[model samples]
Target: MNRITTLLILALLVFSCSDSKGNNDTNEKLNALRVELDSLKKSKAEASNASNKQIATFLTFQENNAEEAMNFYVGLFENSRIIDVQRYGKDGPAKEGTIMVATFELNGSKFMCSDSYIKHEWAFTPGVSNMVECKTNDEIEMLFTKLSENGKALMPLDNYGWSTKFAFIEDQFGVSWQLNLK
Candidate 1:
C-alpha cells in the first residue's frame, strides 16, 4: 500500500508538470498572435490616413508619351506645372528615360501619369472626360483648336443652347476633354 501511494503521487506530479508546460506554450502563441494583429492594425491605419490626405487623377500612357502630354497640358493651363518626374533606367522594362511616374497640376487640379510597360487591350474612352470651365471666349476657342489638332472633334465649339461656347474633343493622346465657357 505504501509503494502504490508513492507511485500515484509521482504520476500526478508528472501529469501536472506537463499540463503546466502546455499552458505556457499556448499562452506564448497567443501573445505572439496578439502582437502581430496590433502591428497589422497600425499599418492599415497609416495607409488609410495617407490615402485620405490627397487623391489625384491618374493617367496611364501606353505609348511612352506621358512627358510630352504633361508638358502640353502644363503649357495650356494658366497655373500649371510639373511637380515631379521619375524616369526608368537603361535596364528598364520600358525604354530608358521614359516616365515611370509623373505628377503635375493643371489650373490647380492635380494629375498623375505613368508610362506603362505592359500592353493593355483597353484605351481611354469618351464616356469619361475632363471637364473645363473657361473664363473667356478666347480661352475656350484656343484650347479647342489646340486640343483638336491631330485629334478628332466630337462637338465643335457651338452654342449648343446650354452654353455660349462648348466643345468636346479627344486630344492626340486619346484623352477626352469638354470645354465650356462660363
Candidate 2:
C-alpha cells in the first residue's frame, strides 16, 4: 500500500510541473495583447493630431460689407493682404458688385468672411471677440483708436491687474476686439 501511494504522489507532481509551463504560454499571450493595445493607442493619437491641422475662423457680415471688413482688417495688420474675393453676379440673390465670399490675412493669420444677402437677427456680440496681443503700448493705443472709430468702447484702455494695457472695442462693422499689450 505504501508503494502505490508514493507512485500516485509522483504522478501528481509531474502533472503540476507541466501545468506551470502552460501558465508561461498564457503569460506570453497576455503580454502580446498589452503590446497590441499600446500600439493601437499610439495610432489613434497620431490620427487625431493629423486631423487637428485643418482649422480656421469664419466670420459673417451684412450685405455688401464683407469686402469692406476684409479690407479694413488687412489694412490694420502689418503683414496682411486680401487673398481672394468673390462677388455676386447680376442675376444673383445678392446685389451685383457685393461680396459673396472673401478671404483675407491679418498679421499672417488667415480668416474667411462672407456677406449674407438674407438678414439675420443675430449680430456680433461681446461674448465672442478677437483678442490681439501688442508688443508696445503704442501698438495697443493705435489699434484701440482705430477699432473704436464710429463704434463703442466697451472697456477703455487701461492697466488691468493681469496686463499692462488692455481695451475692449466694437469696430465700425460691429466686430468686437480686445487689444492687449504684452
Candidate 3:
C-alpha cells in the first residue's frame, strides 16, 4: 500500500509541474489579443489627431461710426455691400440713417460695424483687426504699405509661420489692419 501511494504522488507532481507545455497555447492567444488591442489603440489615436485639424476661426472689430466706416471700406473693395443694418434711435429702434449695427462683406469675408450714438466718446482700439489673406508677396507688401501710409505699425512686416510677410497696423481712421501673404 505504501509503494502505491508513493507512485501516485510522483505522477501527480509530474503532471502539476509549473513549466509544463499545456499553457503555451493560452499564452500565445493572450499575446495575440494584446497585439490586437494595441493596434486598435493606435488607430483611435490617429483618428483623434485627424479630427483636431478642423478649427473655425473668425476675427472681430467694433466701430463708433458704422455708416461712414462701411462706406469707406466699400470703396476699397470692388465687390462689397451691406448685407444687413440694424439701427437704434431715440424713438426706441429701427430709425432710418441711424446705424446701430451693420453686417457687410469685404472680399468674401464678413465684417461687422456698429455706431454708439449716445453722445459719448466711443473709439476703436488695437485689440481687434481684420487679417487679410493675400495671394502673393507683392500683394501683401502693397496692402501693408498702403495701409501703413498714415497709420502706426503695431507689428512690422516680417516672416511668420502662416505667411511670407505679415504686418498689423492702425489705419488713419483708428481702424486696425492685419496684412498677410497666404
Q: List the candidates' TM-scores in order.
A: 0.70, 0.69, 0.51
Task: Compare candidates 1 and 2 on lDDT and give the better one.
Answer: 1
As a whole number from 0 to 100, the lDDT of residue 163 in candidate 3 is 66
In candidate 2, stretches whose alpha carbon ends up further than 4 angstroms from where it belongs are: 1-53
lDDT, candidate 3, 1-182, per-residue tens:
44435545554554455355667755555456556556666767755654564532222223445677677777665567667787776675444456766777677456666655454465567787777877878777777777777778899999877766889989766788888777
Return model 1's CA RMSD, one decimal. 17.0
How do the residues 115-159 of candidate 2 rate in per-residue lDDT, one tens digit apiece?
899899998888999989998878888999899999989999998
Q: Any idea what lDDT model 1 has? A: 0.85
User: CA shift at 93, candidate 1, in angstroms?
Assistant: 1.6
Candidate lDDT values, in order: 0.85, 0.79, 0.66
- The local lDDT score (0 to 100) that residue 116 gets in candidate 3 is 55
Best by lDDT: 1
All-Cα superposition RMSD per candidate: 17.0, 16.9, 19.2
lDDT of 1 at 76: 91
1 versus 2: better TM-score goes to: 1
